[model samples]
Target: MAADKPTAEAVAEQLARLREDYQARLPAELAALTALAAGFGGAESDRARLDELHHRLHKLAGSGGTFGFTALSARTRTLEQQSKQWLAGSLDEVEAQAWQSLAAEVAALGETLNKVSPPQAPAILSARDSLTSDETVQIWLVEDDASLAEQLRRQLESFGYTVRHFMQIGDAEAAAHTQRPDMLIMDILFPQQGENATEVLALRPILRALGCPLLFMSSCDDFESRARVARLGAAGYFLKPLDVPRLVNRMTQILDQLRAPPQRVLIVDDDVALAAHYRLVLLAAGMEAEALHEPQAIIETVAAFRPELVLMDLHMPNYSGPELAGVIRQHERWASLPIVYLSAETDLDQQIEAMGRGADDFLTKPISDAQLVAAVRARVDRARQLDAQITRDSLTGLLKHASIKEALEITVTQARRHGKPVTVAMLDIDHFKSVNDTYGHAAGDVVISSVAMLLRQCLRMSDIIGRYGGEEFVAVLPECAGGDAQMLMEDIRRRFAAIAFSYSGQAFSCTLSAGLASTAQYPEFSGAELLVVADEALYAAKRGGRNQIRTASPHPLQEADRP
Candidate 1:
C-alpha cells in the first residue's frame, strides 16, 4: 500500500503537468485565432487568414479534447463549426450573433482553463495523416498576387502537380494558345480591372479549342461574380485563402471527370460467327459493342444499340449493306449515324456506288483483327465527336437549344403519362455581357462553365439541365414544385455567390436570376406552356433585383413552342 501511494502521486503529478502544459499553450493559439477573426471583415478580408484560423481551430478541437480540457474542447468545437460556416459563406451571409457567441466561448474557455483542476491525462492519440500522395498531373496557375501565387504553387506542386505559375491572363492565354495544358487553375481577379479573361480566351480560340477543364479562385464572394464564372464554365470554384488540400481534392475530381468512357460500337452483320469474332476483336481493345446477326432486325437493333458507327456487310440474305444503309438513313434519327461497309466485294465502281447509297466508308475482306479494331475505334470515336458538335454546346457539355427542347418534350411526355409533376426553370446570368465586355470572352466562358457545373452538381441526377444559349440555362425538374425548385435554385444561388472570381490581382463574383413554374400548379399546361410561365417568372426575377427567384402564376402565360 505504501509503494502504491507513491506510484499514484507520480501518475497524478505527470497528469497535472500535462494539463498545465496544454492550458499554457492554449491561450496563445486562441489569441492567434482572435487576431485572425479581427482581420476578417470588409472587402479586404484575407481568405488566407480565415483558413489559418480554421486550421488552428481544427487542431484545437482535437488537441483540447485529448488534453483533458473538456470545456475548452467543447467550446472550441462549437467555434470551429461557426468558423467553417463563415469560411464557406459570403461576407453578407456571416451571422453577427454567431461570431459574437464564438468570441464569448473563447473567453469563457480561457477562464475555465484557469480555474479547473482536472483529472490525470490518459494516453494521447494522434490524428490520422492526410492523403499520402497522388500521381503528378500537369496544371497551370495564373495569378498576379505574388505571395498567394507562390504559396499556391508550392502547395499544389507538393500534391504531385507539375505546376506552372503565370502572373497575367494574357501570358497564360499566350502559353495556352501555343500549347494547351492538361488543366487550368486560375485566379478570377487579375491586375487588369477592365479585362474579361473569358472574352479574351474566346477570341484567341487556340487555347481550349479542344477542351481544357478549369478551376477558379477569388477573394470576392458575390452573385454577379459567380454567375460570370458559371458562364465561363469553370469546373470548380474556390473562395480564396485556399484550403490547399481541399482544392487539390477538387482538382483530382475535375481530372477524373474528364477521363473518357469506354468506346461503344454497334455491329450489324448477317453472319453470327463473323460478327461475334469482330465483337471479340473490338472488346479486347476496351470497346463496348453489340452484334446483330439478322438483317431483318437491323432497325430494332440499331435503335436499341445506339452505336457510334454501324458495321454493315454488303451481302446478306435479307438485304444488301447499301440497302440496309438506305433503310437506316430513312429514319430521321439515324440519318447522321455513320454506316461503314465491311464486305468481300472488291469492285471500285460498286464501292463508289455503295458510298453514294449512304454508306460512309468501305473495308474489304481478309482484314486483320488489329486493322478491324483500329478502324472501328477510329470511326466510332470520330463519329461521337461529330455528334457532340451537333447535339452538345461547344463549351459546356449541356445539350444545345434544339436538343434540350427535344429532351424537354420527351421528359414532359413521360411525366404526363405517369401523372407526375414537372418543374421548369429559366435561369440567366445577371450582368453577363459586362463580364464578357470587361473581362473578355475567356472569362465569360469560365462563368458559364461554372454555372453549368453547379447545375449538374447540385441538382438531382434525374433532373435534366441544358445550356439555353448565351448566358442562359434551362432545367427540367421532374416531380418538383415551384417552391421546392425555388429552394434548390436559391441553394445554387448562395453556392455560386460564395465562389470568388480572381482575375488579374482582383477578386469578383456573379449572381443568378431564376424563374420557376410547375405542372402541379396548372395540370393542364404542357411542357412548352410551363416554359413560357417560367420565362415570364424569370423576367420578373430580372425586374425584382436580378439576384433573386420568382415563381410564376399557375395560369398559362403563353403557348409553349412545340417540336
Candidate 2:
C-alpha cells in the first residue's frame, strides 16, 4: 500500500492539471458556441456555421463528462442534437422559436461550467516500466559437450547475445531458479546418467518454470527424436554438425516473433484535451499513439504515421468523421484501414449511418481509460494480422515484391531527406535452377527459405529484406555504406554456401551472389535506378564467379536510356 502512494499521488496531480486546463479554456469555448448559435439562420448559406456549432457542442458534450462535468455534458448533448436536426432540416422546417430556444440554451452553457471536483484517477495511470530495445538478449546453452558449448557461447557473444553455458541440466535448473534467460538451447542426450541427468519427461517442469522458448539440438535426425522434441513444444530443432550462423538465425527469429513491435494508433479529435487524454492512456498501455487536431491534415498524417487503427471524432468544424473516412478509403492502399468513430452520438440509426459511410465501428464518448486501451489494442492487433496476410509473401513471410519496392522507395526518400546514405543489395541463389533440376521443387523451397532465414538472422534488424521473385531477393539497408554492405553480403554468401541441403540421402550445398548499390556512390539515383544498377552488378558478379559479390559502377553520364 505504501509503495503505491507515490503513483496514486502523481495520478491525482495530473488529473487536477487536466481539470484546471479544461476549466480555463471553457469560457472561450462556451463563448464561441454561443456566437455560432446566435448567428445561425438555418439557411442553405448558413450551413457551415451550423456545422461548426454542432461540432463544438459535440466536443463539449464528450469531454465535459470525461472531466466530471456530467450535468454540463448532458445539456450540451441536447443542444448538439438540436443543431444536428437543424442541419438536416430545410429553412421552412426550422421555426424561429426553435432557433431562439437553441441559442438561449447555448448562451447559458457557461453557467453549467461551475467548479466541480476532479474525477477519480483511472487505472491506466498506474506506474509501469518502459521496454527498451537495447537490452541484451539472454541465452542459456545447456550441452554436455564442453567444447561445443564453449564454441557456441563465443559465437553467440560475438553477435551481442549474453550466453550462459551449463554442462548439466541440474546446473541449468539451479541457475533458472535465480534468473531466467530469454531463450534456452539444450541437447537431448546425456552420457553421464545420474539424478542430474534429467530425461525428457523430467525436463518438462524446468521448461515450464522458465517459461521461455526452447530449441533442441541433436546429432540424431530420426523421426522419433524429432517427434519427442515436438511434443515438448520446442521452438526449433537443429541437427548435429550444427551451423552456428543458422542456429543464431533461428534464435533471432524466435525472439523477434515473441517481442513484436508496439501497436500504432492515430487519435483524431477536435478536442485537444480529450485527444491528449486518449494518447496518454494508450501510451501507458505500451502503445504508440499520436494525435491529429487538424482534420485537413488527416491524409498527410496517416501517410507518415502509418497507424494500424484510427480513432476519429464523429464531428469536426470542416469535415465529419464519415467524410474523412471516405477520403481515406479513396486511396486503394488505405481502403482496409480501420476507422472507428468516437463520439457522443447515442442514436442507433445515426451510428449505423455513420458506419455505412466507412467507419468500422463506433464507441460512445465518456469511455473509461481501460476501455479505450483495450479497444485500441484489439483493433490494431487484428489490423496487423490482416495486413501481414495481404502484404507478405506466403512462403518467406517477407514483404512481397510490390510491397518491398514501395518500402524501399519510401526508405530512400526518408534517408535522402535526412542526408544519410542508403544501400540496396540484389541477391540471387547461384545454380538455383540446377538444384531444382537435380533435386526437386520442394527441395528448392527449402534452400530458398534457408537463405531467407539467414538474411533475417545476419542483417541488422533495421534492415529490410524481401523475396523479390523466385530465387532472387532484395535487401535495403538504411545508413549503410556500399563497402560495409558488400562486406556483409560476402559474409552471408560464404555462410550460405557452407549450409548443407539434403535430398534423397544426397548432401548438396548452394551458394548465393549479391550486388550492392549505395546512395554514397550514386547520389542522384532513385530507388528504381538503384535497383537497375544493382541488377547490372548482380550479372557482373555471376560473370566474375558464381559465388561472389559485386558493387555497381558509377552511373553513366547522360544516361538517355535510363528508366
Top-TM-score candidate index: 2
lDDT of each: 0.72, 0.78
lDDT of 1 by residue, 62-116 (tens): 9888887676677678777766777786644443334444543543445435334
- Segments of candidate 1 deviating more than 4 angstroms: 1-264, 555-563
Output the worst ten-in-a-row residue range by lDDT, candidate 2. Answer: 124-133
The CA lDDT at 256 in model 2 is 70
lDDT tens digits by residue: candidate 2, 314-340: 888888888889999999999889999
RMSD of 2: 18.1
Name the regions of candidate 2 deviating beyond 4 angstroms. Answer: 1-138, 145-164, 173-181, 188-212, 216-253, 267-284, 290-306, 312-335, 341-348, 362-375, 410-420, 554-563
Error of 1 at 190 (Å): 27
Number of clashes recorded per candidate:
65, 0
Alpha-carbon lDDT of model 1: 0.72
Q: Which candidate tops lDDT?
A: 2
Measured over all alpha carbons after superposition, the RMSD of each candidate to the real structure, in angstroms, is 19.2, 18.1
